[model samples]
Target: MTSTVRRAGAFAGVGSLALVAPLLGWAAAVPFAVVAGIAVLVGDGPVFELFARPGDWEEGRLHGLIGFALAATGLGLLSTVEAMPTLAFVGAVLTLVYGNLAAQVVRRRSTDPVVGAVGFVLGGAVGCWIGILATALLNGDSGVAPAFVVFLSASGALLGALLRSVLFERDDPVVVLSVGLLLWFLWELTDPGTVHDVGIALAVTVAVGYASYALDTASVSGMLSGVFLGLLTIVLGGIGWFAVIIVFFGIGGLSTKFRYEEKAQRGVAEKNEGARGSSNVFSNAAVALAAVLAYAAAPIHLPVGDGTGIAGGIFLYAFAGSISTAMSDTLSSEIGGVFDRPRLITTLKPVDPGTDGAVTWQGELAGTAGATLIALVAVALLDSVGPTGAGVILVAGVAGMTVDSLLGATVEGGRLGNQSVNFLATLSGGAVGAVLASGLGIAAVA
Candidate 1:
């Protein structure tokens, strides 16, 4: 606990520096940088939690000193190379702090080299990009402006809290609120917040979530989580996208219930009848949620503006792939049990019905049909996918399903786990769709 406090303090200080880059130059950042450096350099305390070192005085002090030196060197380099040295320094310092912190924290979390490497790459990329942008913003800037400092500080703290929640500690309501507030902050940056818009989004999320629960589409816990993710989708994807999510819930929920007794007799029924829990929803929709975020971040040529144009955009393409893949997997799994015989994917030997990694011709066709159905629906409503994009979605969905089977036969339930595999399958499908769209010249470079 003591260490947690100290580590939190250090992270807070680092976050403050990063958050202030746009509003306050290094003039305002230098002191906080010093504080963060000192926090990291603390010879004893929670700082050691991150670096995966035993909290021994001798070893701790050496690591602390190294961390401090790295930070100082980063700041120095930023000041030398950037036109807006103050902002540049702050950005560079933040990049160093966040990236290194993420790498260390990830190392502590996982022994897997792949996981650690992925963490490092993502954290470093975000840090460096933010730093470079700050440097560019500093061009022609003369003095520090006090305006927006308070707001930006809060935003910074929110990000800090989020980093800790995701990477270091458990989730908190405060952190959740921080996410909402930051999202609100971003939304308000474009225009004034209207009660109508907020009310409608909330109402939609509540209605759909509650309806799902009342209708036994999900459990109570599932409803709560669904509301959260659903509301987030509204914020990120808008009403049209939210509609697609609902379609999935309604259809998938019904399918799970269909012939539930028969499936149960075969010992292939879904847990809790047809009702799903939070984990199930997340496994299916998380990648789609990420796709929505990626889409909103950049200006893309959406298929909505006109029927004939450049591709609907990477976000649209990826979202389609993700959703289609998830639906395909679901339909295939649920419908496959009706087939009397299944073949093992690896050896092509006959396997018991519903065996892990087993595939059937009937299941494959059902899965492809499901993907095509979802793709067509997206095209009709979202207006963001072309025929080519839809085809890519279908192909990727099939690929994701096949890969999921391969994984189910191997790493799943051992190293990767089922939920993790589901997320990966959707992610793989999204990636495939993205690549295919790009290769086909359907999506423009963003």
Candidate 2:
């Protein structure tokens, strides 16, 4: 059989098992288990080898198929659909089958990372739509909205694509299995948000992300990360919170262009002409993202402040502080390049402009300004973060920027990468903000 026919047949065979699930319930695992066993026993056999890429058979790729069966069986055992285990089984099986098939179609089109990511996202949505339709038809009701399903499935697929990029040699089916299971868990177990909220968030994030990409302020992965983070931010905290993140990104990106030609001549310009990527985005935003998640999970009442004050105030402080730190650090490095000689933070000896630990008075001032800008924005937008809270954010940002310099001078070039230092700086900023909030009795922990 041709490769296309083989693929179609495999998808069909696995998908057909969903029908059996409604009848067999837990027993539906038998056929998949038998296939897994055959694959394991045959390891390098022709049936497995026929579809394997170079080095795949040598890595015992067939064994990876076992994960699919295990995932479906786990879903069958744990989740319920319409209070029926059998229908849940059908959903899991169909999700795995369709999601993997769609991912395969995506992977075949290009080797470019951005193309693969875009394809995976679109494919995952299509797969979820199909899975929902199939389940609704087979079981007479799906009990889920297609829009939310598509959103969750796309999120899963994005993760799968990122994982595949990191673990490039892993079998695609195994990666898709993870996506399938996650989509099911998200759809069944969690209350992410309403479809209307998700839809608006998605639309806004995509529009902003595309504009950023077009402006060449962010790379492909940077744009993707922005969309993902923006969507989550809007969903959790609303548009006001999302605006803070965008402001940081916008100002930070623009900072790199300040006297761009001079910085380039000095060999201190950011790589890729100041276009940010995934590593840069995550490093700066990791703590802020954590704070966002914490805000989402915060309790209705806390030990300090009246009613709502302490409950959500602490996370807001941390979020503002972390974002402030990111902006501060970026401006310090970028604007510092055009100033007079910079001294090494550790030795106080003049060094090259771009030296990891270099610092200048102009740069320090610029950093302070950047931090203040973020703090002001936070205070203006968030009712919970008043002037006092903004002060804490400003202090945290400067403190984190100092910590980053110290780390860079001491350990960054040797033991830690630049991204690691950036993450630590943001983390320190968040911690400082939280501690200051507690000390001030704004949001003391219980």
Candidate 3:
């Protein structure tokens, strides 16, 4: 069949789901998922191809369809209240259908990649907003506030646009599925008091993400992941926690640019002009993010400290340690590689500047400075961590940086990628911080 026929078929198939979604409620996800799975095994042929763009991978189409089926079904189950289920179902259905159509139009009309990206993001937001509003009018209630609607729109746009590119424009269903799941989570898990903070968190995250992209400090995927992380920090850990991550990003970017021309000539400079990708961002921040989540979920507060007391002391310390380690490793690699002669971490033998496991006195000092700065930020902004806790966090960060070098020397290329090493380093940093803080009876208050 021609592309037009395929497109029409996809539209009809997805649109048909929207029409019957009210009746199916949460049960709508299974049949389509089952069909997509069977299509994957037997080969979708025209069935999957109809949802795929030109030159798309055949295998990815199957995954994409399956993801959409799950998302569409899952969204409807977001609330158990009467009319809320149908409202969510129709809103999701129209947002996705209309958003997909808008993206197609923009792609055909504009060859500029920037234009295409903006169109896709804005189109999806507009689609979701319109869908939600229209559904609210018809259903007489959306069971959510206006701010939440905006948040949902933003979430949908970011998830769909970013994931599509991150996944290489294949497996588009993953994007759909992620967006749906995230929306459901937000709807269900958010505290009522946090409703006021939601808008600011989103605005700040988006603005910073755009700035990072414009400055050439972050790739598209990097920006997306960073924004997601930032939003979580602000929403879960509060703006103070978000500030620590921002400081790390700023410091990391500045460090990358330090002695850039010389580092480039020496062939040790970061690729793509030091614009970080998704892998780099995630690896560096994963442990810190986990710490933030744990802090948010802590049920009891310790009585020893002034603020969050024990829980705050523990998780905030871990968050600080992770961020400090990431910054330390980044600065060490970027600045240390430029100023001093390097020695292998394992044998202290002379080595090239960019050699894995290379270490230098200057690099170690730079890493220490980076760790100190992050720990200081935690001390200043977080109520739970004082001078003593900051000291422990700093120590943990330095330890993690040491671990990174040792790992790099021992098993970097053989058993672990650079990103994996970074992740382990951050994880070690957080773990060490948690241990020390708990042992010291530290208390971190919100």
Candidate 4:
């Protein structure tokens, strides 16, 4: 057989076997074969030149073995436990193998086997842990599958890093792997039983996909922000309030990306290129604390609306507020930006759409409606809101917005940085929302 035909046959055989690994109970072996086969076919020619001088066989083999092991371990875990469909695992493994080959093929190839191994191990461990937690928490299923998910996630990330590095030499594999693992961990935490595993998985996938894409695009700050938010959300849970905060920050990041790209073309807004500044931390913390206190102080009653338990109530309201706040900010900003006219938040005078501390009539109305909708939806989803809860959310949302405006116009703008301001504003708005809801007897005063 011709060399080309032989190579093609080998590749085709690997692909077919990969597709049947799960059914055949050989998921672990697929990654190993693919990695080794690619290494053999690619020869050690470039690998030797890159990592070793003319007579350095020891260095060359060590490097190849390290790369192969890392790649195999990652792919094996992802396939076995993550329960990723066969196609994805196969594709990921193939891509990484090809990437390793390409990297070696390059003129100035710089492959760090040690760094790659570390990334593979760390990323794989984190990914597996997250997959296990998510399956246990969300699916309530118990099995020995999480190990595979971790393996696959790690493998995909390692391959992703290598490919990124080869294509974009400045790209750092360790950073990418770390960020990817962190995102997976956060995704797992938010996998509440109430939500479908598929939905949660999709969200997690989007987060991971975005992180990878950002790395590829060389948006390091964006990637970091995505990782940070993912971690924060996981730490906070899938409650409405935290979701809202995520949405707000997510939108802000997107807005900044758009602006940066626009300015890149125009040679403007270069220095301001980083994560968008926001004031969500204080606001979220205050809101969370208030919810906790209110739930603790209020009369604990079972079947209050839908779920029983003080924890449930707190989660309900916090999630509600988070969603409301996030939507309010997004709708206001997006709509306000398009409105023919916008006004400063402190004053009713016209101002630019993107101006901080600015609010247009259109924006205010949009924001109010957005927050109210989120609250109402949350109440309905939880089946907690009676007529009273509905009314409470309306009142609380308006009150929250009012407080948000007040804080934004005064304390938020006074001295604190953007993060501080967001935190304070979210806290104030959430506190006001909770207080108003409780006072009005809309949501069991919690």
Candidate 5:
């Protein structure tokens, strides 16, 4: 048993590295070793605890390592070909840290190897993709940077994971994992280059599509719709495309939240419901397309201030909203789930946990506050867009609450196959908010 355990520990370490190898590259092994050594030296707890049991140690460890390798290898390959930017590198590091932390938390709680493996895979892939894209766009001199980025990123990942394990012990692993990955991906794509724009757009679209498919809730039709929208945004430009992606993330979160509640209430054998929702893809695509159309159809030019011309404003808007939505949703759901009272959205009356259209005062207030915070973030980040641009986000967030309520009260309750209607409603609300803000002379159109 002792020998098996030791062998399992060794395998787990190597396997985890292997899983991230594609994205991190073989050089990532150095960071992995460094991280593991630091973890051991700092008395960070047992490094081998990620495995399930002595009997299952070898398999479990191997699984984690393999996932790490895959993620690292993929990221490395993409970065090499695309020449990622510094921001992308940062994003990757963040994802790695957060993802591993989340996995550790889950493992401690459930002793489920599958969950841990999934968490690592998801986190690593997301981190790598984000880092590669960001680097490609931001770095003026890209060739030399990527070689060192992997090690630096690996170190960051270790820090993030350790922080999660040591600090926020009770936080939901799924939420943390998802948000970490999303941020990493977004940051990578933030730079303003034509090639970066196209590559990021394509990557986002593909990722969203795969997420939709993996979740199993999205139909083939809905996935196609998302892809079509993504393509359209790319044709339109970065601003438009990015805006759409943000909206999609928000909608997707809402849908997933609802589905999880429903599944739990039904006493069904709860599968991983996270993979089912496609609201993120739909909302994001819609926002991006709208921005492009706005730019194309409008007589006035909106100054984006990023040297990328008028389209920059649109991109900023989308990017801000997207990041905000992802953050807000994660915060709201994870924090609010623990709230003493969760209410329905429609009547403000307290209802059962899974009741459609139900709103808890706690949840409603929390959700609004969360959305507002995100809106503010969007405004603050895109300084070039002007204060009026911030106002648009505020209005959109407010309108999103109303739109979400309306959809939940009517369309969402009806269970019309997917969450497309809700997504569309939110998109409409955002468009209305943007239009009103523009018309009110709060901000000039680029």
Candidate 6:
């Protein structure tokens, strides 16, 4: 276990270094790549032992691990032909996956797709991070390269995967912090105007966190302090995507406070009277943050229909939809509870105002209205958003709200936690928005 811990820590550091060095040549990063490959290959042995749950592993030798190391070392030679560290890292990943699969075949092991993917991303990210960092440190002077964006985005995926992994369920909070910064350091290659972005998110988070604190929205103790800072950084990094989030915070925060006493009396009020902690924020906004990052990092263009393809795509719609979905759900639950008679969405049977899956006409309307308001606000902020995009946001919001209700009626608070439900709803809304935006030009021409 001690050895496993050391390996994990060292690999995590390697990933952090890789993230910081996107500008370096793949050739220069060969050494870092070799080390990371060895770390992962060796760590697999004890790491499997340390965190392995029942039915998690199969009989295997070090052959696959050796092949992975050799492949990485060979790919490092690609620096002679291609200077890009990301490319070399990609080759290593492909080699590692193939090697692992061949090992599984030889051992007759039953592979879990989820676990396989987790292993690839988690370990691959660390390897990639180190490779890029070495390259940049050894040969950098060109000011933030495009490879940095590629690294940051990859790191985000790795960060998300690590966060959601059950390996840390029983572990200390340090588990998250350790990997999170390593992944975030991937963005160091890019010199974004973070002061403005961070300032915006911090100013809002502090004000809202403080107000919620004063209003008993949640106990200050329950609030995850780190979540606030992390969220601010995410928003700041997302650039134009921050406006919709601000809209979400302003509206969602107020709705939670509205009729707080009545909600408490009725036993339907949000826990802590909607003074959300870190988990609440993450549940409601994490998907939105991811959408915004996707948009800002790589804007997906939709064809405006005049011959140029993907000229009209606006990922902002997806970002707005996620925020809209979160707000719609919040507004309906909070505002609707105060003004309308409750009806069970599943059965149409009257229920107490706070009953799970309960809905009110007033709440439904408020939810739709909230979605519309945010859709407009988001588009206005971006100086983008067509009639079709706006309408699609509204639809996605309503759809997500319904999904939330369905989850609440069945699994929420039990098999699926409230945070999980929120994440699913937001994700659904983002997908809907992206799909709709993809066809905006077609609809416009039609």
Cand. 2 TM to true fold:
0.80
lDDT per residue for candidate 6 within 351-395, as digits (tens), equals 877777889999999999999988787557544566666788898
Instruction: Summarize candidate 5's per-residue lDDT along 164-187 as a digit string, tens digits.
Output: 333332232232343334334433
- What CA RMSD would you report for each candidate? 10.3, 4.6, 4.7, 12.2, 14.2, 11.0
Model 4, clash count? 30
Clashes of each: 1, 0, 9, 30, 66, 12
Output the lDDT of residue 286, model 4.
Answer: 41
Ranking by lDDT: 3, 2, 1, 6, 5, 4
- Following a full C-alpha superposition, what root-mean-square deviation does model 1 have from the true structure? 10.3
TM-score for each model: 0.58, 0.80, 0.82, 0.45, 0.41, 0.57
Cα lDDT for residue 14, candidate 3: 67
Let me know the TM-score candidate 4 reaches against the reference structure. 0.45
Which should have the higher TM-score, number 1 or number 3?
3
Answer with 3 or 6, whichever has the higher TM-score. Answer: 3
The models' CA-based lDDT, in order, is 0.61, 0.70, 0.72, 0.44, 0.45, 0.56
Superposed by TM-score, candidate 5 places the C-alpha of residue 128 at a distance from the truth, in angstroms, of 29
What does the lDDT come to for candidate 5? 0.45
Cα lDDT of candidate 2 equals: 0.70
Residue-wise C-alpha lDDT for candidate 2, range 1-446, written one tens digit per residue = 23633553474465556565545544655666666666566656667654444444567665445555555555554433334334334544554455445555666776665665666566545554565566566667757665566566556545555555445433545554565555544444335567777777888887888787777788877877788778767766767789889999888987877888899999888788888887899999988887776676554323234433565667877887888899999999998889878999888999887788899998899999999998888778776677887899899999999999999888987999999999999999888988898789765322
- For candidate 2, the clash count comes to 0
10 residues in a row with least lDDT, candidate 1: 145-154
- Could you say which candidate leads in TM-score? 3
> In terms of TM-score, how similar is model 6 to the real structure?
0.57
* lDDT per residue (tens digit) for residues 1-446 in model 3: 33634463375356445544445545645555565566456444666566655553534555555556655555555433333444445545555555566666677777755455566677767766766566566555756677777767766676666665567544555555566555554554345234467777888998988888888888887887788788778877877799999999877976887888899988888888988877899899999988876665554333344434576567877888899899999988998888767999999999887888999899999999999998888888877678988888899889999999999999998999999999999999988888988888774454
Candidate 5: regions farther than 4 A off? 1-235, 239-272, 277-280, 283-288, 297-340, 344-347, 373-377, 380-384, 410-421
Error of 6 at 212 (Å): 5.1
The ten-residue window of minimal lDDT in model 6 covers 94-103
Query: How do these models rank on TM-score, best leading?
Result: 3, 2, 1, 6, 4, 5
